[model samples]
Target: MPDRLDPKRQFLADLFDAAVAAADPRRILQDVLPPPPKGRTVVIGAGKGAAQLAQALEALWPHPCEGAVVTRYGYAAPCRHIRVLEAAHPVPDAAGIEAARVLQSCVADLGPDDQVIALICGGGSSLLPAPPEGLTLEDLQELNSALLASGAPISVMNDIRKQFSTVNGGRLAALAHPAPVLSLIVSDVPGDDPGAVASGPTVPGRPAASAVLAEVTARGLELPPRAMAFLQAAAEQAPAAPPPSRSTTRIIASAALSLDAAAQRARARGVNAWVLSDAIEGEAQEVALVHAALARQAQHSGFPHPAPLVLLSGGETTVTLRHKGRGGRNSAFALSLALALEGQAGITALAADTDGIDGSEDNAGAFVDGASAAAMRAAGVDPRRLLQGNDAYAAFDAVDDLFHTGPTGTNVNDFRAILLGELPDG
Candidate 1:
């Protein structure tokens, strides 16, 4: 493909690359590996980054450790000692059910001398869909779809998922019983809560079913009937604290770390960079509006931060699918941001998922700038209509602005950078 991005666009893209590189398992996972146990070390995990974590673990550990980890299709990393299983993500499927079973079996029949290293990261919630007893995978699948469309934040969705899951909320650790579990996590959630990542498979503590159900009702999320009924009954029963499990969690990589890395890169290039937050959340478009306001302020008023500055933020954003659109939250944010800017000059922004897949699309995300809307019109595309239909992919593709960086092998949620100042003339 022709190089369509200018130097300013390339600068934003470079920042994103720096952010993702900061979370690479091979670079960050080695120092956190625990000492090998005397009996056995079982490796089990699920997420977009699980396979990469397995590959890193296999390379770092001297002693032999064997187990399996599940990742999204097309995300497998080769490992000699650890098995890498592929499964669906953001939605549960039969393959995910089997993957969950494999993970469960991997940690079972272990002794106190044995140890389990959990390679946890984002997307594991969907990859390991072990439905609770009395509920079927179909029920969990239905719930998963509803949750994704409900526009709820990831943490809220995970709270509800913990109620219906067999493998989440530290049950995986409890299942490993006598064997201690050490969860090496790449956090994708806001606030860097280790328990919120991958629904805390190794970390203990499940909120009461009643509380989860209440939150669901408050959010107006319509779960499947079977799952809803189960939650109702479980809610009535005495809420029991989760059984104590010997599990230690370490957040090896997170959005904060990645954002810091991006800022450092910006500074090295002689641009002042200010990180807005590493935990920004809400509807993608709404969040984009806030970012647009900031960019405008910095560009026109020179308040908050002066010109030639880049504002950085990292966190997961949601896209409530009101239309049958073909774009993820990152793309949606870019589109909305373009509209909000109204062709304002001297402002360029990039929004992308660090995993190199935004929602279910092939592209990681897209770039937007002062001219994005004008370019869409010139291409005979209606940017407003596409944005309303939740089809930001078409908007960016119309302008040849869709950013692709296939499967980065690790994830730390969204990476957004907005640069204020015009690109220098060649």
Candidate 2:
């Protein structure tokens, strides 16, 4: 590839790749070792990165091990001893229910002499769904659909999920008590709060069910009767998560680490890299507008430094789906920013999920340029109308700018970068 290609475009792509690589399970699992116990070691986990993490453990662990891990469909990796199971993500399915059963069975026989390495990451909460008492999988499925459509933040959504699942809310750790657990996490939540990541399958902390119900009700979400009953029962039995014991909890990867790696890559490519924040949260469109304002300030006043700088950020932003949009929050943010930029010259950006799936769409996110408005106009696509419908993926696809990278097998939330200058012409 020639360096003469638009710097704004090239820098954004490079930064996204750097962020994805930083969250790769192979790289993050190297430092996670506590010497295999004398007894058998069981590897059980669930997430988009669960299979890959299991594979890494199989490759690196010195002792004999056996277990199972469930990952999102098509995200599984080859592994011996640790069986890899595929399941639906963003929704609980029969396969997920089966995998949860297998996970429970894997730990059922372990005693204090045994060790359980829980390879947790984003999507695990849904992937390992074992509905709580008085709740059926059908009820869970309906509640999950409502939450996904509600556009609640991941923290709140996971809080709600923890209340309905048998394996979440530190229940997994409680179930495997006396068997020293080592949780190696790939954080996808803001602040890398273990309790919020995959509903803290292994970590020991959780909010009460009433608090979760209050948030859901406040958001105007209508829960199914069975789900409501389950929540009511849970609220009555609401107990805080147990204190953290000797179970070693380690955050092997997170948005901050991914953002830092991206910054270094931008600097290596001779672009000044500035990470705005790793804990960004809010509605996707609003977040995009805020970032656009900062970009405009950097362009006009150079308060945050001159052009040729790449602004980087990592965080999971939500999209309240008022309309029947066909895109994820990352793409929504990109489209919102593109419209705000309104053909401003010498600027290009990309927003993508590190897990390689933005929302329910196949593409990670989308790329936008100074010419986006012009291109959309020429294509007869109204950006405002699309934004209103929450159809950013369709808008970007029309412009041939959707960035697709199938299932990177990791999730650290979203990676975004904006480039603010043109490269030297060839």
Candidate 3:
């Protein structure tokens, strides 16, 4: 793609790289680590950034460190002491089931003098799949698949996740009783809710379990009978585990910082870059329409920013699986944006997940420019039709424009950039 002959493509790619660098765990973890305790220090985490966060902690601590972290397959970072385990993401697997159990056991038998430093980020809820008692891993997997298919928002999804996890919803941190816990979270969910990131393994979840179950039922998600009963019983029988205040939770990386970094880079290159927001969320296709509309306005009227403007944003987007396609949220959004742009000239946009995988797909996302529509037409591919089937990956793949950056070791959520250049010689 580097030789695609688009003048703006390289710059856009650089902008994305800058954003990823800003949220890299290795750099952010350098300053936020709690001073090494005199006693044993245990490192634990689950997410796309878990391994990277653990590796950074191992590098900085003054004494010995031990524990484990679970990340999506192809996302593990090399570590000498901390165990890095790979697992399926956006859906849980037996490997994650075991890892979550190990995580719980890792914190067990700890003395009051011990310290636990947990690293968590996006994709964590799926990475650490520990089902509560009375529910099987199959039950949790079926529930997760339902949630992903339902296209529900992260906030709602996490609320339900915390209800069934043995280690999540503050249970993991609660294990560190007497032992102080320090959690360094890289925010992917909007508002940076600690309990939602990786299902809040170290932090308590919000929106009471009963409320989450209600939201899930409202969305028509079908949980396994046992899973459904467990959640219902949990809500009816047990009170919402009071949110945990015991852990020292700090957000060291987030979408806002990454967007700021990208915007700064754009400005350095002499372009007018504006960050729309770091908290944007909604259905991927719907959100793409809004962004496309904004880009068109910038092209016609330059209302918010001038020509040569780059509208940037970061946040998670949902994709409800009606037709059951392979594309992730970013690809779906890119395809929708491309169709809406309708081959408009002097405009190019990129949508990608900062963690380097947009859902379960190998490509982080895709790039759509003024030529995208034309290219698809030439290949006899109908972008709108593919989108109708929820097959965004196929649409983008036909054009050879899918952006692939494997396991970026970070998760600040989606990053989108709409670069609208000056109209040709007006």
| Least accurate 10 contiguous residues by lDDT in model 1 | 1-10
Cα lDDT tens digits, model 1, 143-163, are 999899989999999999998
lDDT of 2 by residue, 1-426 (tens): 222435466667778888989988778888777787888888889899888888887777878999899999889899979999988878889999999898888877568888899999999888988986676788889988888877778888888887787778777777777799989989999988887888887777677878877887788777778888778777787475565444668899999999999999877877777899998999999999998988888888776767778788888898877888799999999999999898688778899999889988899998887778678878989988998898998899887888888888789999999887754343
Clashing pairs in 3: none
Q: Which candidate should be chosen as best, given TM-score against the real structure?
A: 1
lDDT of 1: 0.91
lDDT of each: 0.91, 0.84, 0.85
Tens-place lDDT digits, model 3, residues 126-196: 88888766788888888898888877788888888877877777888888787888888999988887767
- Model 1 clash pairs are none
If the candidates were sorted by their lDDT against the true structure, best first, what order would they fall in? 1, 3, 2
Model 3's TM-score against the true structure: 0.95
Model 3 per-residue lDDT at 75:
80
Question: After superposition, which runs of candidate 3 have C-alpha atoms over 4 Å from their true positions?
Answer: 2-5, 238-245, 422-426
Superposed model 2: Cα runs more than 4 Å off:
1-7, 237-246, 424-426
**Range of the 10 consecutive residues with the lowest summed lDDT in candidate 2:** 1-10
TM-score of model number 2: 0.95
RMSD of 3: 2.3
